[model samples]
Target: MEENLRNNLIDKLQNNTISSEEREELFKLYNSYQFSKEWNENTMGNFEDVRKKILKGVKLKRNGASRGKIYAINSFLRIAAACLLVFFTGWLGYTLILKPDPNVIVESGKSRKEVVLPDGSKITMNINSTLTYPRVFEAKRREVKFEGEGFFEIQADRSHPFIVATPHVKVRVLGTAFNLKAYKEDPAIETSLIHGKVEVLTAKEERTLSILTPNHKFVVDKIALITSHLPQTKSQIEVVPMEFIDPSNTAPVDLAWKEGKFAFASSPFQDIAREMKRRYAVDIIFENKEAADFKYTASFEQEDVVDILDALQLVKPFKYRKEGNKIVVY
Candidate 1:
């Protein structure tokens, strides 16, 4: 093909009017350039290089080749493959590389997310939750921190124990399934043991270390002189047996959010509202503080946001309205 004729065909091919003959010619050009890496050079520094290469194929100007005769294609697979390989291997003479590390994931919102750690320990994260962890296991010890709420089921290891650190308290578990609730505003931290045992350590000097047994719960309770003095606000670690038809049900509930369910395992009204904020990406405010303690005992059939809210309103007495994507309290 003459240079002028080839340029006309290449332009037509790029414009979607390519005929069978032109398609074959384009493929030939692509293959020729692919094998001829001597002229390709190294343009792997920026991701945009591959982008442009895909939109515009590499074309050489020979003695008689038309200046406008350039091969182009939308597919940039070859460029992507070459650039990715070079970038990851640092062959482009660059010192730094962009590598993503491992993460700790937590879930909670009108629901919870339960995660098993690298060492076989479990974490039940509560609504719109997140957890950060190292990609590889460290030989010394496994450590994780939580923001909102979660339950952990840790595989027991005598030599390497599991440790969970919140802002003020640290709970080390040998091998156990325990619930940890640490809301930022709330003063108390609750660690509910579902199985096995753990040691709860606090920052305060007055309280000694407490050994939490299965079914016994741990809470850091604080109190001030309020309406009644019987117990102003007792924040201490205590154990209470967890009711179970089959206690393992906690895992499904903890993990339901990842599968897209705004779950509520008998969570309170305000607690559920906090979850609504996270799951629905809305703001929830309470007009009354007394509404905070309203307990709910029903499990919801996993459904859409509107359906869940309607069901909750009927099951519990509360008025709510939707403002844009947000649900506000009157």
Candidate 2:
């Protein structure tokens, strides 16, 4: 596209006068520019150049102004610097604000990430999770694809219902705060609501499985559904109250991981080990089959993996040893 045409299209977008065809043309241009060699080579250098100019301006004006005046001047300079930085950073601002393609965010190893959507909804992703969302939602609905686990604080839009699609289930809500765990290796998919209401639905059929209220959880038994040989019609699901370690404080066990705390209630040893493997970036091997099926409840905050293993042994009397990079339990 020509520079004049690009500027004209951008002006139309800013004034909310761009037709659908023009928007499509702008998106195609952005997509082409994103993959060009110029974008790859010049982005970082342009950012550095803009940063230096902003810093030079700040230092030059600091000595000439009063304290109050300097504060105001610095604030104005910051805003100007941001505008200049965005202008020179190629089409990044435009892509983030106007692109039609979905954006994928992945959190791997032991790290967590916080993502804010275009509509101001917040998502805090757990380790080994992936979320895919568009830069902007459609006029009629807001939707995203998710896997693993995430804590969502959705922005309320009654006209456009927010939907989260996982492999096994879907969660629909108007505006709510909730934690959804749908790890592939886990036995079940758990959706725990903190506040507001949500409708849980079947992924394949889009059938309503359950409606959840605050301090409640909806669970889908994935293992049972997968293993059953007969023609399965209804999914084995359960609705239960959220677990609280202390009734006085009323903190849900589902949200403990967000606080850097691991809390489990009568969870299987193999399932706990899988979570530990992701959280600590270590492999756990079970030499004894009985140990893998052992049920235990435990909670720890900021403890080393070895310390947690040792603590668990004191209660259940299981033996485990570190063998190179893997922890072997017998």
Candidate 3:
């Protein structure tokens, strides 16, 4: 009776006419067999061996059959072949299709790019940033790897939490909008939460460093953490409060790039030069080291490289000259 029921369930499944209850029963049976030690040990071998064994059994049966019995025997062989084909196909599908290569990489170079993930989450990637994500999310979570800078607006899926991984840190959120800056060349990794909540973890140890709420910013010095071993002292990671108090009410300083605006609050000249190169596709060379160390507070909306440089000159005395694709600063 049990064998008959199992065969019937498989038939229903193959024919695509299985009821929900019957499907559940079939799944239970599949799970039981899938977890068995014998199944694991046997299923690892090549499928061709199983096919050869089935053919051998059919050949032995054909030789033993009489002329009158041959017609019945042939019919039985046909059914047996069909059943074997279905069983092997199902087994292969279960073993192979369950764990596919999930990594799908998206990168932006020389220009900013926007990406929409499988789960409706959106990422506005800065120039030279790369994002690696699964083609399809796993059962319990949605995760992605990110390099450089990106502003993320994640969809609300509390059951399947979203995670973004960088070289230095991992940010996990159920649903949130945030900006992440984690350039390999940069000394620090920064996460500024616009809304909702996010938990930050260290990449090497998977230790929960901080949990951020709306209007909070988290910064970690990569060099400090790597060079020092002061567990009793203050951690290299720091959390600070940020306000959205721009006169135009556009966005926070960290997230202003998403609006095609370059806004900086006392940012170093070298850092500004790096951002300028990414935004304008031009190389900036500081002739003087003192010029690179200068910090400036400024904002520009769709300004040309020459115009921005001119504006900077008015605030702080600096000489700049453009030659071909390169700008020399002193």
TM-score of each: 0.52, 0.65, 0.65
Score each candidate by Cα lDDT. 0.60, 0.79, 0.80
Backbone N/Cα/C clashes per model: 22, 0, 0
- Compose the digit string of candidate 3's lDDT tens values, residues 1-330: 755675676566555576666765655555565323333224223334433433444455446556549888888999999999999999899778975666878889867899999999999998889999989886698989999999999999989999898877789999999999999888888999999999987776447788998888998888765543466424777788763438765568888777778888777889899888878888999997898988888889978999888888888888988899999997
Q: Rank the candidates by lDDT, best first.
A: 3, 2, 1
- For candidate 2, the per-residue lDDT at 37 reads 36
lDDT of 2 by residue, 1-330 (tens): 565675575556555576666766655554564423333223223434433443444444455457769899899999999998879675886677675556655554467889999899999988888888887786688989999999999999999999999988889999999999999778789999999999988786336778998988888787654533344624466788888766674777888888888888777789889989878888999998899988877789989999889988887878988988899999
Which lDDT tens digits does candidate 1 get at residues 98-127?
444466455455565566667666666766
Worst 10 residues of 1 by lDDT: 222-231
- Stretches > 4 Å off in candidate 2: 1-109, 223-235, 247-249
RMSD of each: 21.8, 27.9, 21.3
lDDT of 2: 0.79
TM-score (C-alpha, index-matched) for candidate 2: 0.65
